[model samples]
Target: MAILKLSAAERRRISAFFTCLVLALVAWVITVLSSSYNYTVKEIITFKNAPLKRAFHSLQSDTVNITVKGTGWQMLLSKIREANHQIKIDLSPLDYEDFVVVSSQLPAINAEKAIHNQIIAITPDTLYFDFTNRSVRRVPVRLIKSIKYMPQFTQSGLSIIKPAYVTISGPSNLIDKIDVWHTDSLVLKNINEDVTTALNLRVPAEGNISVYPKTVQVTIPVEEYTEKTLELPVKLIGNVDYYNVKLFPQKVKVTFTTSLNRYADIDEELFEAQADLNLWRTYGISTLPVKVVRMPAFCKLVSVEPGNVDFIVKR
Candidate 1:
């Protein structure tokens, strides 16, 4: 490595040159920011202090494009600020109309006074909104969930929702059409145990519609299932005139699977197995298929021994 030393005058000149360069860069930035420029931006419009008895339904527009002229710094700050430009329209003094113009009802903008941005023009300066009579109703809430249980597991009882219903307040037309509200779709696969979760309800984009309880708690009861077998008598259906009908197997073994809590509640009498004799009389078929006429709701029929049985008729 070689060391080079500079004279005092040369070091001073180098230092002054870099300082001037930095100053020039700062000056350029200041000039660009201070200069006035025109820019177009989107502003969201929101209403406040709406009448309790009346609801503001369909709005002609929720946003408007406004052209503003101000310094570059002012424009940049406005774009980066977190505050939203809102226009409040007092509805207490206004009468009910099919549509109302918002420009005339718009209150003065006091929040933007500090920004010092001149509003050149606002597109669709005349805003319009549809008004309707407000109404409230209590509607049931339904849970939307896709659930699958593992092997040997089944839902024991009905699924319960903490708050079975919700209150909705909106336009009379919209409220009359809504009978129920549903939660967001949820999926649970291979669930072996009970599940409880809180889910949000579906929210409409319409500004006039509103739900009192936005979220609800759902509980799914699951239990282990056991297989049970029962010997049920097979009755002969239809009339057998002048002929004695005898099935090879008088009784059938009805195998079913149900939750443990409901296993003892099931019995052979709950199920009805019968073979139709009309088929044999009409078609002269010796073998007839046995069908289960009734069964418990909680019990799932697995199989029926000797699904088809032969009948012998002799006088």
Candidate 2:
């Protein structure tokens, strides 16, 4: 009791010493508190080297669980996206092997209390994604024209080009599956002498393939009938010169392929061939415009025996 009583200076020195000890104790507590925490370590995720287009579609899901540990304060401060937070882990660089995934130290984050540092589980919905290789290729495209047939005419007659095949190259996986592609179709009406038509080409339903050259030539077969005499209609193609005059045979001998069904109701009056006499006069030529006056509409002009004749007129 006697020693407890001290001078003012002694009391002041003892008080300062106590204060310093208390401060040191407080500092130690704070350091310990900050170091201990409950963190969650979540599951591991796997990713493959997929095509760019397909990879973009895989990130639609939200909320991945990762486990962490630390003190309540430290854990609470841990957030998914802090200035130093790491929200996701990449597994692309790792080789495939059987091993347990461990928690990787990340930056401080503010986590919800509910997420109290605990070992969490994580998983993905899809696995084994297919990587597509997209490439451009040159494919042989044939024209397949769509035609409407007359009522009650159920493709009575039709002809297609032989060896209907084209070469196309693209991605190995995509091109390998295509054995053959088809064009649309060509339809016809009744009472037709002979008609030539074009068709367009298209890809099969199961393929997403594209062709480089978008178009190819296709000729539709025409069926013709026999005709003893058919009128050749005159066709005025190019404009006649001011001083030139054209003359037509006025009639043509028509012969068709021997088919009764083909000749029926056929229009053979739309063909005509005329010789220009004005051209001969202008050139001061004696033998000019010596072509046949006309030929049958159904008959294709093979060769004009005497393509020209001598028509002389004094200029």
Candidate 3:
């Protein structure tokens, strides 16, 4: 191996040269990235101000290619944001004309671009629509839920939704097909307390179908549950053959869980323990299955003690 020794002055010159090279590279990058440029991006098309008297179905597609003019900085961010964004166009013009020019909406579209980006042109610059008879109807809202409750906690009563119905307007054929509008799934996890929240209705799949009051208020009552047990008198049923029949066990212990608020009001009167005598006539079995046929509302049945009882029949 060979080593090259340099003087102090030589070392200083080498350091200065390297420093100038690095500075020059950074300045070049900044100048290039700051300059203005033009680019193209794809965007989804949406409509605003649809006419009420005339139901319309767009004949053109729901997409467009937008040519944008902006600095280098906007070119980097526009592509990412454009994918999630839709360019809304005014449909009021469709009242008189069947087609619309995208150039007319450039000013309004550019106003929302905060990155100094301007829309230059859009492919398929004209939008066209087909007309049909319009119809309107009011339909009830059916809420969908995917919820989980903590141990011994559950929903106490029916969920309440404000403005129970939503109005839908669209082509006559489409309007007739829709019956009830459904809300987006209301999801909750390990919920122990009452819930009051706003939920959005499902988005219309067709371009012309419109729903009013897209959002609804939902309230669900939640409560912790406690166990209750009662000795209910067992009744016999299905002895139509007129044979004297008797069951050894006349009562059963019914165990169930109910909300804390309803625990006091729940009693044996609300429960029904039954033993069917059809077993003795049809299957000729000595044991009859005892079942709880009725119970209080919002109560969960845990078990029925003495599930089977011995029975004797005299013909």
Candidate 4:
């Protein structure tokens, strides 16, 4: 075989091709080592109560850190934004453990360096609820209906057909200090006849309580009758100084014509006949209010004819 020497141009061309290939390979290796990728994570989170569920729903703690490794180009393309990155966790799977919560699993990352990598650690907060049973108690009854009296005279006293009381149930701690509930108010402005009314009951102001038998039967006794033809002098009983009331008609002339049996129980005191000017005087009111005078309990006012008498007052 005859040996032949290669041309210089041919050798140079071959060397150049090999060098270009090596440089390209080196660039690719650098890109792979410098890049990073994204890994996904799933963890179980829990809260003490229903209200606190939102706080730990997202992995929102600095304590949790995720790190991934991959080609530099891939890592640059991947994003680890806090708002976009999320961990899947279930709360219902939790068992009663402690007021403070611990995640069942650490967040798994979707990122990778292709080998073992750290995802993220998660921390959760817990909330608690208290439940208990309470006993029964009695509360006051409040009337809801409105009443109007005759123009000349007003109600002297409020009579109840039956006493008012209600039973309530609630938390044990709150029920202990409570004795009875007081109703708001019952105002009978200008009623002058026998009236039968039903009243409603209400709880005290700003109270957290559960009442038994939500509704109750309330009866208000009302009646209107003429005064007796017989002139009966007015007599006052009970300490008036407490109410600050002044009696103007120190004595009223009650005139009534009735059977001896009907008149037997009639008296000034029995009829609750007296001027309740006590409240009025406190506010500096001078006009005397027209009201029934003292009379027998059994004798009802039939017709006074004149009804109210004019009296002179100093104070």
**Cα-based TM-score, every candidate:** 0.73, 0.28, 0.78, 0.32
What clash count goes with each model? Answer: 0, 36, 0, 52
Q: Which has the higher lDDT value, candidate number 1 or candidate number 2? A: 1
What digit string (tens of lDDT, one per residue) describes model 4 on residues 1-315?
998777999989989999999999998888665756554333332222222222122234323333443445444444543324444433433234223233333332234122334443333333232434545677665455556767533333454523466776656667677776544355667765555544445553322255555445444544444444544444333335454334545555555533333444554445544444443546645544445655444344555423443433343
Candidate 1 whole-model C-alpha lDDT, 0 to 1: 0.79
lDDT of 2 by residue, 17-135 (tens): 99999999999877877776545543333233323222121232333455455664656565552333334433342234222132331231223234435443333322232234544
Better candidate number, 1 or 4, judged by TM-score:
1
Report residue 255 deviation for candidate 2 (angstroms). 4.1
Clashes of 1: 0
Q: Report the error of model 3 at residue 212, Å.
A: 2.4
Find the candidate with the highest lDDT and give its number: 3
Off by over 4 Å in 2: 1-228, 231-259, 277-306, 309-315
TM-score, cand. 3: 0.78
Clashes (candidate 3):
0
Q: Write the per-residue lDDT of candidate 1 for residues 4-107, one digit (tens) a residue.
A: 89999999999999999999999999999999999888877665555567766645677777677888898888866527564444444434554445444433
Off by over 4 Å in 1: 1-15, 31-39, 45-56, 66-74, 77-123, 132-138, 169-179, 240-243, 278-286, 313-315
**Model 3 deviation from the true structure expressed as Cα RMSD, one decimal place:** 4.1
- Sliding window of 10 residues with minimal summed lDDT for model 4: 48-57
Q: How well is each residue in 34-100 modelled by candidate 3, as lDDT tens digits?
A: 8888788888888898898999998877889898887776787776756566788888888888888
Give the winner by TM-score. Answer: 3
